[model samples]
Target: MMKEPTIENFLEFEKKYKCNSIKVEGMPIWSLYRYEIHNEIKKQTVGRTAEGSEPPINKKDLLTMALNALKPFNYRNVDVLFVCDGRRSKNADTGVYENIYLDEISKKFNSVILEQPENRKHSTPNGMDNVYFTDRVAFKTNLAVKLSTKFNTPKRKRYEAGVRAAFTDIFKAIKEEFGPDITDKMVDEMVDRMYYYEITKKYCGKILDKAQPKLIVELCYYLINNFAMSELGKERGIPTAEYAHGFAFPTHTPMQFNPEERISVLPDYHLTYSKSQEDEVHFPDNVKLVPVGFPFFERERDRYKAKYPREEKTIVFISALAEGEQISKMAAEVSEALGDEYRVIYKLHPKEFGYYKERFPWLANSKVEVIDNSENHMFRYLAESGTIVCTRTAALQEGIGFGCRVILLNFGDTALNLKTLIEKENIPLVDTAEEITDLIKNNKAAFVNPNGMYEPNAIENLTRFISEIMMN
Candidate 1:
């Protein structure tokens, strides 16, 4: 087994793979896992992390876990195909990797099996490659079903029903939204689903073709959307681990599904961010919950320099998906309510800044100032601002580290209630702009630093765990 992992150690490790018997002949020992490792290694730098322009994760620590997983396998031949899990596969692997480490890491890797980001475009584009590229895996057996064999009239009878059922589900959703009548809404929904269905169908044969897998590692991404990768991994009886890219069982997501379904779809090992996070989820006996603390939050807490005792007039609202417009509107309303003394600095998520600008053209005219998100770190906003309001976002979790007095906004209704899971002492769920205004106006909210949610040696714990699993 390896000790401290570095590119040099990895290169040295590859030297043992000179024998022909141990050489993985057909597929490059499935490079997807290595690609994830490469990305995690890249994550361990200063001012850089997982998602765009926010807090950083200790991804280099995660790369350590990845490297450690290889300790037990003293293989002689190292030809591997590091596949990308498309874009949606981005998530928490083992809790080992975080932003502080990931901050300075670069995009390139110095290994033969590892792949780069552009390699994904070549490997899994929406065009013909979405199915399967033979360079990665090309095999067929009576037990395995191929997409090409079932592409036509009677040959594809089993698949046609599934396609029809999907369309039916889309139409049902349309009916739910647009009332009991058929209209253009249903047509649009159907057309969109049909287009995707046809496109995705091409990938099935390519994905399902028989191929030997030494081990299957799902980047632990959107399993429902990208089930092919996970499903193929399971069907092949390969040892698979799902890296919890983010909250594996968030209040808003897989946690809402049936335990049986989640368990069935989940990888053999379900990695988590922390013990506090893992304790909340009741994963099945088959799924081991490996809790590695949040690397970004931990590192920040250690190095955090407070910027408090400043001007109290500015209010920063951390934005989330689908709630940007609502929060922005409320910021404007609150600014108008509180008059010129108080201003709402709406920190828009980087991805939706353009959309919000186009949606609210009067943004410049109002007291609400949309923060130039690039200019400052989110923790700065939490420290300097008066009150923080947000929808379901990682920012809220980070808020706990900064002693942020947060209010969870009830944006649009969904089955997921973020507060039920992410319970902290300071946060109170708010449903209206008036409630938020009252909190700010009355000075009812107080920011207090919480104790001990982060573990100091998370990287070590995660590395030990992944190594033990792979070693067995």
Candidate 2:
């Protein structure tokens, strides 16, 4: 019933744009975005996988595909570029292939450029003269701030008053607890620790008895832009500029902003590109979105049934517990508490699997299985699961779609608001393991509310938008 574009349509797009060069930019988290576009474009235009391989690709394979895609456009003056956050800090293979891909793409175009952090000291092939390095902090600050204001939610007067009160309390606590002997170094350390603590709690599931002095410092940095600007200037050893020049792509919104120019990417996508650093400015207008795809060997139902055919346990799907170890541990605790009564499976985000592997090595040998394969789709897991437990993941919607029980855990202030939506829409919400166990014990069926939140056809909309941009 859905109208999907064919491979031919994508090939036509490649020809039309003469897409000799494309700059791929964004964090590792955007791998999903990259994979979709790379797969679609390669299949349609090249009539093969871009990496000269089949599905389930790695960094090298993907780079090969990117190089292959640009091979046909060799006659054009334009060059394709691929950019990423400092890959050296992340993956060695990724950083190396990024350079390799840039070199290969350069052979096809007048210039192929790969941008990396100026501070990073990774050696690459010298023949790849197209490789360009730039100040990572400068580029990031410029780009992020430019696009940040656009997504900034205007604070209500009441919220502002609350913030002021919270700040006053924080300052009072800091002065009283740390004493007047607190040096600048002490203050900085305190702030850093608090920031780490709060973030760990929010994303990773660590709770604090009270707000730390460090949190107050971090909050001050966030609220007082001048302070951050001054601190960054000191750290970079550069004169503070009046306005930030770069652009950023915030997660909540795909929009880009330029703080220095006070311009937004909504009106002009051209600004998304960096002018000085060819490697740094890669922003592709086009994108593709693909579902987790059909049944695979890693589907939770298949694996569980195959392993334990006679046992009947309620299945709870914990989607992508990869961001923070604390959060993963909390999910693990919930699972442990539930025990044999329920089977809890933690699905790691494909992009964050590496992080999970490093942070939770014990998971490899634990009773809890971390599903890492791409073939094991999210929807299939949800379809087979009895309940889905998550902290603001998109998987909640999919679980709901499959009529699986939904539990929003440790939402804090957002809890009541979410509860209202669930009540109005007739969806269920559980915040604790005890509550979840009770729901399962009672044999509750999750109600589907027709008026529940709507997820747009982001891929189709994005593809069509990119088509229009290219046409212009």
Candidate 3:
């Protein structure tokens, strides 16, 4: 495992470079460090944090950071400015704040910058405000090409070539708009600088620098961060451990907030459009719970029904099909133990389906069906199923809400808290496939009438929380 870098090292780099001004464009949703920069350091805001907290700094911070990093360079005097889209702000208020902030900051700088690779602008809500926001030094584009090359197949080569062509076109357009002197060599060098500064340092081992998707995302961050830092007149150097910010959840890891770390957390269900109450847990004072909204409730419900036609068999829902192989094998054992009486359905992670499909072809053909469609409502499937089984998936809560026989599979000591939660809530726990079979056979009626364990308001609570966060 890679050792987590120390904050002291990161801060040392920040101080050494004299990176006084920082411009951040992404949402501070999962990333706590962005909040530290904006709220604690009072840097300018490119936009609101994920929880809708306004940053202290405005667009000028980005310009200042960029200028400081690339001192003596005349990018400050450039007539055009390019601003790429980062995380989406909550609402029009946030959008307007971003626009006005950028406009005010641009006036303080010299360039009339344009943002884009053209295609990325499609998702921005306010297109008019993003006329010139493109980063020629895209790490993603390069990474895609590198991945394609590494794979080294006719199909992969074609994909890489397509990416390169698209980037080249965008680069050409930007150069034509600005001037021919923004040579290809200069662009390549800048992109390289960004790669080292933003990506290679953090994701050195987990992702190949030249890999397609990894490269692309890293490049995007590099371009955006590099531009902002350059405007602030800071020098690009090997980012120290202190410069390494807090790890963002979702983007960094699928797990919940570390109880040991002093970090902010939005309500678990609040990040989605569900209106669920924040569950009380021992959290640090520095952390705040922001709400999230779920816009796809109805659509998700409809999709779930459409994809997994409900059947008579008891449904056992499993998340992280890749990581929960033992649970799956156990499920299979339970199915055998029960004979033809039960139905087992495995909900495969959408991204990992291809791998799972390859590994478990039996699941595809067996009475046990593997559902891979994410657009479908997972909760709905759980509702219709007879029982739900998982070691430590969030789906257990959803299953209980649907009045299904929720079974907790104790994989290891890591899931002790989950087991405790289930036991305290009076949720059922099964130790083995034989026990699962016995429970199904003996307590079929009780499983269907689960009492005092369901909380259907999770969606509503989540939605309300998100709205509140955004509005606040």
Candidate 4:
């Protein structure tokens, strides 16, 4: 009998041969890597000494092979109805985008409709299209979640193996294409992203059936779900586009440079933040990059005149993953350094505040008033803040928009791409707590956009871009 193929065996193979995948001429990085792994296993095990035996295939391989096998959905008719999902961020969803931008966009076209998995939805508007991938994905995910509570069973473990393998494929694929410039943390992150991305594709067939939208427009197209949604639209011959919600830094994923033109899954049109961001991603020829301003910036608060300048000293610290201690220590340091003149406000990411709280027990003892907003009101802190500090977060960009003197704590595994943004934006990147104090005391940073970082006509550009794609 052939040796049973396990994730352990595959991982051992990966660690040994992880850096050895050669690029195929026309294929994308992942397709070539998958091909190599599958063939290498077969070449070693299935021939020569043994008379007749086939190499054992793993679950992840099976899924990847099956990805392009299915014929796309064909809905013969068409409506100008635009379909998209709600913002995964609760704050962004309920805040302004849904009520303001989405409503305005919806009104411009024939109608805009929601596409959400039926079982997973809650309090979504009743009139929207209900997609049906929840039955399949929910069963697998719920079981994994339940089994994850204490320990996973052998059966659960096997499926978990598949999950890890999927993530591994994604990580290897990025490295194979982009070379060794990627950080280990980013590779790991993109893997989990690929796993979630695969689950989201399970919705495409359901979405296509319910609403054969002429064009699919999504918020935050960079996210796995929206990206997956747009890819599915392309598969079925529908035009797709995305509105830029934030900066697309850390450009290490396949989304930045899809290897094969045949399987390029990026959205057809990208409504970007500005010209600076447009030059950042370096996407392929087929993907249209449109420069637009940040629409939400018009609503950003510029009103507060300093009435009592001394008392208005508030330092806001945006938290980073596994850096709870750093945040707490920084808060304490800022308070001590400035005495009663400065107050530190730490804003926690969902990871820090959610299930991973145990990893950050120092939050309880910290002097800073930690906040996690449901209203996307991090802007309020930036508006009122005298100085803002972060590891690597979009809030840093928000701080820029508000004219707060920003500082980046570039310690440990803070993303290299963030360093790129800091250099480009001219924000101060500090290493030690002492450096932060000096920068804060000096109040030395540019208050104006040097690169014309924000284009003024965002909504106009986005609307016009969509109109062009639809017309084409």
Best by lDDT: 4
What is the C-alpha lDDT profile of model 1 across 106-168, one tens digit per residue? 112110121112211222222221122221211111112233334444524443344344335
Candidates' C-alpha lDDT:
0.44, 0.36, 0.39, 0.52
Q: Which regions of candidate 4 are displaced past 4 Å? A: 1-104, 113-202, 220-224, 250-255, 258-261, 302-312, 322-325, 355-357, 412-426, 445-451
- Runs in model 1 deviating more than 4 A are 1-162, 165-220, 223-226, 235-238, 245-251, 262-265, 278-285, 301-313, 338-343, 371-377, 413-426, 446-449
Ranked by TM-score, top first: 4, 1, 3, 2
Better of 1 and 4 by TM-score: 4
Using TM-score as the measure, the top candidate is 4
By summed lDDT, the worst window of 10 consecutive residues in model 4 runs over: 47-56
Candidate 3 lowest-lDDT run of ten: 238-247
RMSD values for the candidates in order, in angstroms, are 16.0, 20.7, 17.8, 11.7
Q: Is candidate 2 or candidate 4 better by lDDT?
A: 4
lDDT by residue (220-304, candidate 4, tens digit) is 5544446566667776888777766666663323234432244334667776777767655655567777787765554433432
| TM-score between model 4 and native | 0.64
Candidates in descending lDDT order: 4, 1, 3, 2
